[model samples]
Target: MTFPRTLADLSTAELGSGYQAGDFSPGEVLDAVAERIAACEPTINALWHEDLAAARSRAEESGARWRSGQPRGALDGVPVTIKENIARKGVAMPSGHAAGDPQPADHDAPITERLEEAGAIIVGSTVMPDWGMLSSGVSSRHGITRSPLDPALTTGGSSSGAGAAAAAGYGPIHIGSDIGGSIRLPGTWLGLATLKPSFGRIPLDAPYLGRCAGPLARTVDDLRAAMTVIGRPDARDYSQLPPYSGDYRVPDFSVSGLRVAVHTEAGCGMPTDPEVAAAVDAAAQRFADAGAQVTRIAPFMSEELLVDVDRFWRVRSWVDYHGLDIEDQRRILPYVARWCTAGADVPGAELLRCYQSIQTMRQATVAATEPFDLVLSPVAPVAAFPAEWPMPFNDPDQPMGHISFTVPYNMSEQPAASVNAGYTADGRTVGLQLAGRRFDDAGVLAAAEWFERSAEIAAPERTVG
Candidate 1:
């Protein structure tokens, strides 16, 4: 029943095969994951509300199935973590905000139910900024979720703790939500693999929820496996569409013949770090070397869309708690209240105008890239920012600056992923983003894999085994 060694030692595919072949039991793997979480939680505070007993019980059930020689599902025996904002049955569902009306969830969110059905045990939930507003994982109520690589550095927030937990080897797979680079930014900062599938590829039963939850894993294979589990049509979510559920058999997708658009300025005016630019340029050349036609494209976004997208995101956060009482609001954190008020304060006319603007931008951006199979760019302007300063809030005028490189896809609802392209001289990570047209989740992953294999940007030993 013992596992090989570390949770870091296993991938989602390896864990599944091990269960199928009787190499180990889910109970053992879950136990190892729990132990790792125990060791790392003191520094990372990754787990918001964990029931070790429930995780163990689920693992035991999976172990029983293995004993009978009937594996439960593709993700059988895998240990995974869910973002706290996503409901887990009977768990407290708080936005981590002071002014928010906190409540316990009555049922599992569709994604959670799907993961459990696929035989993946949810070991715990990771921390997020109240309602996922700021880029820093810091919440006056939830404390800070620091990077495992260096405690002083920030783990990209909203999805901060999940990334830190995964990077620290607490689990092979982690589920995170992305609205404005929540999944991609943290993965980039921590040197992990993550996918923000196109809007509706994964279920979002509640349109009010601005972000869609997706997988964050150490390997592309693990991310693919997790995607198979949760990326499906869910009756609960009107936004979810059928998954591109094909075996990731590398299609006759020769890069040499493929057309890839490179966005050097990333459609936003923020400065792209030389390290990140060089890594992405190098990845593009690798694509060229592999036979893909790479062409640099001008910034494809409109200024109006950029402003409106930011407003829409802020409004979503406010709408979540706008109904609460002043007492409830007072209970939430200051920054959460600040953001919600900001969203509430937007002139009614401007709010309507912003919504309409987002639609126009989505169309224009899609039209501009429709000719290319994939678009490649940097994931963030900088590597890992200091944990002390949360992004978008660190500076007054630069509210959306840190996320400039990754937010367009969220606004457009396109499938995008952040692959570890390379690192800087100081050892900070650099991420190359590959974005594809809506519902081309597999294609985006395929492109990322090509870059990873070609660029040889393996996970660092310090972060993983």
Candidate 2:
């Protein structure tokens, strides 16, 4: 039994089957990933840390388990990477900031523990924006994470390296956290599959709002496999939902009777690139052709509501910034510095107002989508922008434009995902977002799988040189 192509090219499910069939060993998979990462790292800068020696040892253990017909679990021998923000035992959680103490964590985040227990080989940590604040990949600590499809383009963040690594085939699964669009934004830009599960679907031990841990993968099947292992309740996260009892396997559901609403703008008259709008429109048409009910709808959120959400996020960043020493704060990226300062003096009344606004926005979103099984929109208003900009707009006055399509769902605490819609004529990748009612994560994933099947979205050609 021998693998004809690079093991890095196989999906997580494929790799699992290959291991079971004795076509390849987990050690071979890790070696293939190391080779690909070595070729791609100079151009992409996707990983911040790696432990190939440890990963190889785990792979050897998994091989022994497979040979004895006592494999530990579903993910045995599968290569996996965690975003920089996640706590991996013995690995420093820098969160992409230059100022944090370099001491490593003594315990694993629940998700990390679960993955390891299931026999997934932990490869390394992926890069992210400073403190996971930015939507693009430039971080003061780890530098920029460029897209594998086109080096000049941004791999959206704060799950920047996860996107780039998944695209470059460093591994089949990556764990990423999303506060606003961290997971989906990068997934869209890098033409990967990612899910931002409903708030509390995956427990997180962080001092932030709307943060949920999720998986970014080359295929929806791989994403589901990772979710099954990591999406369990942890006592550390009091906010986590009760232990999920539902099967993580994407159900066989036809889109024939599904009701999907399409919105190109966030209803605030935000600017959306024509190419992105066209791609989303085509995706909706494909659903319609497949017998689903599709309708173009007005944006569910207003510009003022979006501004308030941005304000709250900035204030949150400000709080985190001030917690660090003044000298350490000075090490933050300029844009992050700007964000921190902008919210430093917000009035208490204004803070309450922002929370009220978020509540209103959530209610509005729930009401608007109640009539539909799923909602379709562009993952972002534009395709991957120039890598140098912190965001597509990068304007201090209107920094939320690129995230208009994504942030609303975060505020709503619903399950949402970014699936490869298609590429623009200029070769930029476009993503179609599928958002479902809160706690309807399975429905959302099923819809994404349907789209993948119907659209036949292809895996990206490896860009490593």
Candidate 3:
């Protein structure tokens, strides 16, 4: 077997089957991946810091295990790329910013350790904007990552390189983190699968932050397989809940008695593009046709809740980039510095107010949507923007303009996903954002799978199975 259209083209089961049959060894797959990375690196600008030799060494070890009939773990030979923000022992884990001291990471972050333990070789670290403060993928340290579909358009950030690499066929699965639309927006722009699980479903531990991290793949099945490997609980991360109960097995997504709220303005001031609105409207009808009750609401969050989430995100920026050296600070993208400074300006009381308001909003959002099982909205206000331009949300004056749809869920700690609804006449993709209540990851994934299977949008070029 050879590389396929998507990194997910060969399902996890198929990869295992290939390994069992001796059709292709991990070394051979690694060679193909290395070639693809070299071939697309110029245009896509995906993989940032890499050690191809290290990746090959791991592949050789995996090949030895396969020959001995003692595979290391579930993703034994799978080549996976991780976002730069997540730590991997001994590898430089710069968050697309110049390092102050550049000290070696003492240990792999919990999620990275889990991936390594499962035998997925860390081929390279994908790039992100400094501290993930910006959403447009441009950073002084790593340059800008462009969309595989159109190099001129934006490849959503700060999980930017993960999406571009996956789209450019570097590997079958790439890990990414999301605080506010980092994963979903990039996935939407690149025409890939992005699963933003409930905040605490996946363990996330780091030197400075605790945002969630998960895989970005070309198919939902691939995502599920990867999640099984990396989404386990870790004592290092206190925010993680216990392993999900098997009791929530999703039945064939029957909308028969399900209540879904369709909120165009997800409790923010941003306006959905006409094309995006039309696509989401059609998707809601499809959900209705599938036998579900769909209701359109003005917005999803309370006014106060929206304000709080925005403030919280801004404050976190200060926490992420504090005490950096001047050169490191200068190496950050303009937008990252802008947000970090904005975060610095937030007073102590305002930050505390935001956290307190989060509780009220969570409760209010839950109560308001008690009658609904799921919520549907646009993933990004527009399909994809120009790569060099600042994202609407990065503009502090337009907090409600860009991240209007995404920030609330981060505050609520819900499970949300972006599915490729359809493409615009100009060829940009529109994503339908589907969200489920806290810990209802299975439900959200099931709903996303339903829509992904229903809508037959073709994956972008240069992806691998």
Candidate 4:
């Protein structure tokens, strides 16, 4: 089928304008996105399900509402995708794990409910690695969700499918959850803009420390659009911040005079790939170029901090794996299985100590970056690895080594993002991590938004020639 790329590739802002101006109908845009998925999915394997029949119905309703001049919300008629772990009524959330319960969720998760209320037509749920653990797309349940930039490369993970879908133009917006670097890691690998807002900024179905659901979009404006809808307090999450009354879409913002810290080393991860390091340094230079007082900052994360958090998560995932029947446990991706299984051997006292180490990391990260208003770092030390590899190095014994730059911010409860800053040798995108103090999500976003508008080159080459 020959669908025009215009409708599928338009950003949320463009869609809104087109819808109001009668340039196109929601149904037409939906068709374009469906065409995009049809063309991209076979090679990418990004989608877990497609609900076009339902989306078509919603698009029809949205079109009629648009014609009458009364739309449901700001995002009325926009196309979006939510990750598989986010429960939607009548759909089973396999969460990329073969052994996961296949029961249909009785109702939509809060993010889904919010998206529906915002009038965005959800095209479908995307894939992820088993149990949302790995930072790569090699899933035991769903197989590999490869990058749009290069089919041979991974999209990064556990937000794997959402990243791939967003990069592939399946839709303008895709919802993803990030505990460590799930959102930003994939965002960087896929050359998209993604945010892991301050903890509790976007209420989660299971709101634990450092875990929040966020969005992946082509532009920060679209990211703000998604935030305006889903970034609210939910009764389901006791940890949610007080309802955010501030406007997410700012008319203007600046980093002028703000203190900026450039962190080149995460202090514990694989040595930053030379290309990635150069890109990050160039990104930080942009802040200096814009009148922000940028300075080099010492690495705050240590081997102890990284190892401690790794131990805590191992025990945490171990508990989940142990609860599943032995046969189900055997179905998990072997890398993830071997990684978490060792958690069973940790002594009770060490387990508590491991948990406390998270608090220690939180304290250290918060203190270290407190002197600066913003911190710029690398999302992952390297660019995208092979699609078939479970981790960057393909080793379960040291799966977390690449996350040192990202995991600290999770524990610190700070808002952070991954914005495409540069390219690898083969033209793959490299992510430059941007972060701000707890609850300063808007500032972090503004910095990212600024980069998007100011970049001299296109961040990713996803356009069809």
Best by lDDT: 4
- Worst ten in a row by lDDT for model 1: 1-10
Off by over 4 Å in 3: 1-9, 99-101, 207-210, 245-253, 302-308, 319-322, 325-327, 393-397, 462-465
**Which segments of model 2 are wrong by more than 4 Å?**
1-5
For 1-465, candidate 3 gives per-residue lDDT tens digits of 134443334656677778778988888877877877776788778877786899889989888888899997668988889998788778677777765645556778887788788888788889987777677678777787788778888888779999888777676788999876788888778888888878877887752222578778777767777778777788877788888645333876676678988877655556678898888889998989988999987665655666667668777766766667677767666666666576788888888888888777667666766678888888887888898765744465545456667766775788788878888888888888888888888788778887888776665553322
User: Each candidate's lDDT (Cα)?
Assistant: 0.77, 0.86, 0.76, 0.88
With candidate 2 superimposed using the best TM-score fit, by how many Å does residue 262's alpha carbon deviate from the native?
0.9
Please write out the lDDT profile of model 4 over residues 257-306, one tens digit for every residue.
Answer: 98999987888968999999999999888889989999998999999888
Alpha carbon lDDT at 140, candidate 3: 76
Number of clashes recorded per candidate = 14, 0, 6, 0
Across 84-107, the per-residue lDDT of candidate 2 in tens digits comes to: 788887888888889867788888
Q: Top model by TM-score, which number?
A: 4
C-alpha positional error of residue 448 in candidate 2 after TM-score superposition, expressed in Å: 0.6
